[model samples]
Target: MAAAAHQADRPATGGQGCRAMTGGDRDGAPGDFRLTRRQLCALPGSAALLGLLGGCAFAARADAPPLPSDLFGGTTADPYLLALRAYIWGYPLVRAAQVRQNTTLPADPFRPRPPSAAGAAINRLGHAAELATPLMKQGVAPNNDTLYSLAWLDMREGPFVLEMPDFGDRYYTVQFGQADSSTEQALGQRTHGGQLPPVLIQGPDQQVALPAGMVGVRSRQRYMMIAERSLVRTPADLPAVHALQRAMRLRRWVDYAAGTDLPAPVSDQRPLLAPDTRCPAPLHFLEMLGNVLRDWRPDAGEARLISGLRPLGLAAGRGFRLEALSQAGRAAAARGLADAEAAVRAKTFTLGRNVNGWSVNYGGSVFGEDHLLRAAVAMDQIYVLPAEEALYPNARSDGGGQPLDGRNRYVLRFGAGDLPPVDAFWSITMYFARGLMVPNAAGIYSIGDRTGGLVRNADGGIDIMIQQEPPAAPRSVNWLPAPPEPFMVMMRLYRPRAPVRSGHWKPPAIQKIGGA
Candidate 1:
């Protein structure tokens, strides 16, 4: 597997560049770095007409057909098989579009494209977890300890290099993935040290002659992403982290060879991508799957499952026209998708072992190759840090095993020295069903150790107030406000310590205090 092969050959310098590479398959591509940082891949304001997979943009081909009737079989009524095929194959594209529209675009329709505000949703310097912010308004349950910055990249334009500055002892990472949300690379903390090495994304089967101070990690897709994460300790910690984010740059291949200043950002003017974030139906959903398959290189493990897709007008690089299918095939597709959704939901919950009420999951998630699990995750988030970098414990009920609700008050107390074990920081975020944040009076959605003014118990333990209304004045500072309905909470242990990693420190359950 490419992931495993990369792992074995990866340099372990902790982040400093070429210092770890022993001239890893150099292509010595000339004029590799000459473009301005901003011009790395300037996209226009439009979403994709059809998300052509494998670097094939829809409009570029002048032969795109109009939406057809009856995707599989014009006469069939059952769509179980077609539906299932769309659900699994189009999972990443649909998931990516979902997050982009919810987080960045407000006016766009249920089609695909780059979001408005010149990617306003990307690179937000977050404040403490207590207060609700714009990013929070998008309904993401993000951890409080890290300021997240994200942007889509077009690696096919040419190979590019990722450059990040040393953040001293702070924990940070740049997770990259293909258009389908498959794992591309996770370069930070675990890979290199503070002196960040220029990570390379080379051309197809092309060797990257990394410039001095650079290392190589090839990206399989021309269109990829950079999800930046930098740790934040307190409100005062934001500025420095933002600066580091600003310094983070991705330079084009030709620009790197210029040896001088690179040219300014120049847009390909190709319609910038706006992902279609719509409810998956039969025809439209299959259209999405067809496009994504153009780029996603299904490995041997996935080849068989995907092979089943080709018979249904889902072959990669082939144009999909719903009208082509017969009625029977389309009906089966629909039924398949609906059934897949239900099946995936049930399977997702069963994942990882449940320790106490919280799931102590270590692997088989966002970064893995499980198509079904990947679909479920896409229904959630496209990017997720590996367990070693961060561990998540989600609770839907109280310590006594009662479903949590805004109508009830509760407490999640930590015994002295028993707070979530983490080498960096820890936090607890509240989410309405489906992982969205519910608005509250306090303008707060989460809380953590770094939140200012949290009052501690006499024994050095901490008492967190959870409810819709504000708690009494004394305990208000530790309050994690909830919506006026059912809700769930997720505990984040960043850079989890040995104890937590080994499951020695299970997160204390949420103890119900009844309604106020």
Candidate 2:
């Protein structure tokens, strides 16, 4: 059958006999065999998809047993797939109207002219939209469905209506949660009970609304919006609910933008934008296409085809059977593992870019050493502030500069006048070149305001030791241990000012202090 034709119908369901084998009780006890209502609903779809895929393979090799229920063991792959399906269906619907609205520029007679600054803002929105599709497709599931719902509401109403509140000079981050008050309450507690009151203005009492100039306190750095109300409601009321939501969203965005000196917020006093309503139909068809692709055993050509269609398919709001998608993802991952193993066997592996200044020559595939390379490229990248720009953007190059050999013992000295400038705090964190948190002998991978018991020098200068051993006396307060092999560092400055952002201050190049 053609791919599209195969996916047009749902997978064939297995009978009770097949279920007794895979979904049966582990202990083989009589009472343990009962499947709960939720389990039954999930099982039919899950088993059918798996059985169909397994049957295809089995026909080719008669000796092959059916695919195992525990093919990926007790890992998170299953749950991740469920979340991915939800995200795929949820995000595009949520953001569809907003993306369309933003994409409709001023010169287009159909829509009002967005401000000149709208181009950059729309670009960022598009980037977010582009990222949402692929990121959702990756094995990692979203923490919640709020992002999806919010995008849907924006797409239905207009992007300009959803508002992010101004937090004044304070740094802030957006947190998403269910539309009910729970997520907002959690955010309030985290921000010391400083959040806007829940404004669920819907139904008969829903006010037509006006620009409610700066709705919340300027000092509040965090904002939360509960989109569940609109998501859970019937589709008929979605546009109205989205309209109210867009108003609030725009208000918040304006307040926040004004505080940050960003572009003036768009006014929403006019009538609601007419609904497009036609986009979802085509997208529904594309989702069916994705479902079929997930069932096929992927080769290189198939992988490329799926990857290319991923963004377009997701934008069109395709939903896949979670279990099927997971099985397909695992198959793809196995191929990647094979490729990596092949490279290692051929001894033709390229060291990651950051490995240039850091010598990684295999010592007969047993041990290797390079002191100077260890010190300079210890961390993949380092951030220095009161200099806002990242200090090390390019990977360390071997021929570019002499390595600062400090394998066993290293010292980083900051004079009294050289303290990092920040509105809130600063810290230097260490990570292995592989990007995992390093396991150091001293249990120290970072040092900053949060690191307890740091001692300062007599003249207010701080000298930190980056080495394997414990330092003597006051020197212990400044110790950040080194890994036996390669590593890297990152310095973070919270609430950084212009000087740091503009790179007015530069951190001194790391130097070798003593012999290894």
Candidate 3:
């Protein structure tokens, strides 16, 4: 990614961009410098030097070279610590931008990719023709319940008018998100019931007048992401769902006014990143992050956070270059990147409260100052709706608190009249340890209330079979196939009631039922 040309117009520095060091050589003066821990550790026979300096206080030297500074001004800067902060702070924006670029750049910024393809172009919607299946590996934790309609828009020009057709009883939601992966709002059954007015969406700097009756929405950045989910009741209902998708329209305000609003042009652009969405190299990750920061206008608090990163040669509009750091700083940065990635992976399983062996996470819709949580969510499920709109409770353990293994059969039993409490729908989808659905012989990826021929006991309770092998007869009706290895189960409740949102409700545990 190239550095923006606008850098010359912005301030050369932000704030002090350094932390203060105290008890240092007894005096603070310009050019005062001391060896940081990393620098000391890098020296030969450094153990002896540490022992000698243990009881002695050395004076500040005016001759020391200006080393890279830490977030908090310490006489010695640790590049590893600074890099970790940069990764956490920039992951969401970097990931979002990468998706946008990989999806939209293929159309040369002029057209949208076909819905059947992986992604859409900038300023257009790409509707997925079918619901997600095990074969679909484009995204993490793809839902099997809804057909997706994705769009990456550039709102810098003006507000775009998003028109949604009325559906008397269909359950659907259109989620609008900013460049930083923070959901601005979601429009669907819970918010608008069966009907909604057109929404006019603009950027933070855009000063546009809304057409009468059109709802106004603003994004914090020039780029925005739109994710629409239209529930598919059954396989036979796809045609009707496709028709509804075709009726949805998003066009520039200028085009809508001049009567030139037409569907997004069909095209395809080869993505720079791989289809698997694997983690990019550490240095490349920072470089991509710097590219995104160039166009992003963070809020006040975030601005302060970004300012502290300037010491590491990362600032808005400036390219994060390798030559900007010393040899030692570069090595420390590499270690920091690795540590940050591992931290995010570890934190993902611990989000929210653990109940009945499930991690019931809430407040995903809006993330404020919780950078690690935000990054973790982005890594696992990028665009989840709010808890009121939906709650995702995933389990890696069984009722006995043992890790779930597909080699053993398990059962999830819900008492009579104790089905998940939701205003719209509920479903349980199976995934491998890495969060992707695995292919099974049964061709079943998920099971839910809308599942055909789902059986309930005579007493009104439900027992869902979970295993790698196909079960017989009555049990087969409730079977949710799993991979023959370690796996996880995610229960999704759409339009959850207050009970689930307040953590008062919990799903039944998955019990080990003896097929190993």
Candidate 4:
């Protein structure tokens, strides 16, 4: 509600800064000056005077002021902001719709809120969506887009259950939101073999909600969702209303490239809620600020504002500057950015993973016939090499390579025999370090079995080039552009066999070739 309210009050400037222009005519040069040769000869002594007047006149022109610039000096900041806002508002609807289409939930109820665990899970998911926005924008990987449509099905009314359908591999886990007092209790029984059940985890009676914070595992191969929780109700009534609250607030984390290393942890404190249910005014203002970044065109002033971000410590790498922000300002911006990135990342990753899994059930009808999903699903499994393994040559065959430098070429080679075990086909796709499509001369971001014209090496060994520059003619076919900075990759396996599914068929580690 606070987020919505803030969005309403401070309509996004759409990236137009406070100093933006309101189109007007330029002031012409002064009318009194003369420059004829005869006049010049007669007024030699007055030349200095004319030059001064000319300078003043030029400075006085209406359009003489310099245009503003963006923090990274990029011109597309305005459009990027707009895209971000659209992503934030549109993500939830997309996820909810997907769940409705794929899962077998009973018809929507009048109130629709289920039990306490159900509600809490939904709310947690929603908060995760909010936190994911910025991370997604920065190119965090598969988790970036997957959270959009992913949901934790809570069947807690009778036998407590939580189902995460798209978790990689046939891998699924269920958990109890509350602890069981007795091992013999049905609540202690696993709904699905090896899976935990959902339980009612009660918070303090005086607590209204969780303060803005982060959650989820931070891994290149894992999807994450972080957010803030502020809804408050009596502990006794929590179970009754939890489901509805979660349904209304569910969100996902999204990352465009790979997940980021975790930031330093903040103290864990419950956020206080206003007496009224409405969000506070400062939050509204922040939302408006976000809107301005998204909707308004980047004018000179807007550019200046973006450019000032780094100095103000509000830009990427300057997150530490958050400490300097007013408590309220810091809380609002940090929470907002985190939520946005997380939501987008979760949606993207869920989609990518599912798409790769060839789970026709989850692919929306739109992609039912598309080759992309088929190609994604055909691949057996994607292995994410640990940073150390990826950097060192002898750490692990699955992880051997030099440390990943922001700039350098890397090679991930898979022998035909080592190909992922899959009943269908498979391919490897590459995204930018930021997780979006990379800008390559060939416009090809990924390579897979579905790649129609690929020419493989004679040795039955396929070498995929991961670097900033295009490979030589022969190797170019396997080249996947790396971001000018650090990035991540996901290898998908479709219809994976027991070997691939059971970890017997691990992916080869990405090896560093030459200096970046």
Best by TM-score: 3
Task: Name the lDDT value of residue 74 in candidate 1.
Answer: 34
Model 2 Cα RMSD, 1 decimal: 20.9
Query: TM-score rank, highest first?
Result: 3, 1, 2, 4
Ranking according to lDDT, highest score first:
3, 1, 4, 2
lDDT of 4 at 87: 28
Alpha-carbon lDDT, every model: 0.53, 0.30, 0.67, 0.30
Where does candidate 4 stray beyond 4 Å? 1-406
Worst-scoring 10-residue span by lDDT in model 2: 1-10
The top-ranked prediction according to lDDT is 3
Q: Give the poorly placed runs of model 2, Cα more than 4 Å off.
A: 1-315, 318-406, 440-443, 450-460
Q: Per-residue lDDT tens digits of candidate 1, residues 287-382?
A: 545555655565664566555555566665553556556777766665464445444444444345576666555652344545665654544333
Worst 10 residues of 4 by lDDT: 1-10
lDDT of 4 by residue, 255-306 (tens): 1112332211111211111134233332332332332233222336434544
Native-to-model Cα distance after best TM-score fit, residue 261 in candidate 1, in Å: 4.2
lDDT (tens digit, per residue) of candidate 2 on 16-128: 22211111001101112233333433532334334433432111221211223432223243422322232222222222222222332323323422221112122122111
| Candidate 3, 222-309: lDDT as tens digits | 7787777888898899999889888988888777778787754433322322344322343555665676777768777777777777
